[model samples]
Target: MKIPILIVMLLLLTSATSKKMWKTRYFTKHVVQQQDTWCVHACMEMSFGIPQCMALHRWLEYSQQLIFPTLNCCDLITPDNYCNCVEHGGVARSEISSFLRQQFSPISGVFTDLWDFLPRGDIVQLAFLSVRYTSTYHLVVLREVEQVEDYLWDILYCDPEVGYSTRVYNPNKLEIIY
Candidate 1:
């Protein structure tokens, strides 16, 4: 009886010690948008763990070869020049997808029910209508999703415009993008 009890306690202790604890993992450094129209670029930087200038340069290089062959990074130093280069005011989603595919392996897809499918520690892009400007759209990187309770969840994200990572309680306003 004593031997059996000792073995049972040892097994329980071993199992408890071997069990892994859940942890919230996200990007430690937040990358902020360098320019007004560079929100997507900043999000990309945060996702790729690259610097702001490098992200901008990579985008410029990709854009020059495909969208505007004549545009150069130095030419967009001034606000007017940058605005002229980006005639649409912001980068398009298709452009972002194409760039990601070309530079890295195609690793994203559109998912409407993100909360159910999103994996922990994976970075994703989200699009939603701007709170301040209802007619405009904004983008951010979803860093982590934590379940607070049975039906509630906490969303951790990096907002390029805000220049930091923020946690919100069950944000239902945003749409997840690849």
Candidate 2:
């Protein structure tokens, strides 16, 4: 009898702790979607996070609906020899980046690849030895733009799966790089 009671208590405590952890993980101050553009609205109203990033596909769908009311979002993703909605390779990256920039002004830079689409290193200092190549690629908010350092912004994206909870660098710990 006592063993069963103890087990039940342990389970209850574990569940309570897990719930608290989840709450903190998914916590966002606000979330909003524009009538036509979801990504822009999300970035403008809410702080960028993994949850928002994960919803990229969905936002794409929503945007497609607004752009082409007749077609669905899947239609856009589907491959096409002609100029359908599907865009592959480097072209897709550039198109997506351009589309994002057109909708959002807060985004100062963007970096896209055949596989991953992200922001440029205008805000974050990356690994050495390249005037063009950037190691860390993702959107960053420009806090200051110095002539010497160029541009300064807090790191917004780290790992998409883990989600970006805070800035990549802390002024106290890291030095600013141009």
Candidate 3:
């Protein structure tokens, strides 16, 4: 009888704990989609700790409603031809921005100069990187930005093409949904 009462008390206490707690998690270890045009998909998976297949499924559903009703998102997507690959290209900034807002209302958009973004801690922003050789775009997750009032600064991010590179760029309407 006493054991049952004690177990009940413990469960109550655990349920009463604070609900507001933030923890930094690395999803790369669990799953990684090291491919082209899937940067947005990868970032989505990382932020939410979901699998690439699920993300791809959502993309297919969305694309069907918006772009092509006939094409299926689940149909085999190989490196040669992905839903948002070189053949089909990628989704637009508005599509990603709106999708994230609806999916994760906790997310907030910041469309400002990197210099002005005074980040207090590690922040994740969905960014688009222009391909140097061709008229195309790739997805990237803007992870961190460090600056000493313009004298010295650098930005870090992860992408399939670069893996993780630190370079300077004027984000072309960055869909920074944190």
Ranking by lDDT: 1, 3, 2
Per residue, candidate 3 scores C-alpha lDDT tens digits across 53-104 of 5565566556655644454444556556644533443456557666556555
Of the two candidates 1 and 2, the one with more favorable lDDT, higher being better, is 1
lDDT of candidate 3 vs native? Answer: 0.50
lDDT of candidate 2 vs native?
A: 0.32
Clashes of 3: 0
Task: List, residue by residue over 1-178, the lDDT tens digit for candidate 1.
Answer: 9999999999989765742222223244677677777776676666667655556666766766655556455456575554543543365555765665565443344434545444522343332212224655567776656565544567767788988877777746446655
Candidate 2 vs candidate 3, lDDT winner: 3
Those runs of model 2 whose alpha carbons end farther than 4 Å from true positions after fitting are 1-66, 70-92, 108-159, 164-178
Model 2, span 1-178: residue lDDT tens: 9999999999988765642100111123444432222333233334434333234444455445444445443334333432233221111223444554454344323443311211223333221110122542223222221121113223332222222334333222222111
Q: Model 2 reaches what TM-score against the true structure? A: 0.27
TM-score against truth, every candidate: 0.60, 0.27, 0.53
Please tell me which predicted candidate would have the highest lDDT against the true structure: 1
How far residue 127's Cα lies from its native spot in candidate 3, in Å, is 7.7
lDDT of 1: 0.57
Give the TM-score (vs. native) of candidate 3.
0.53
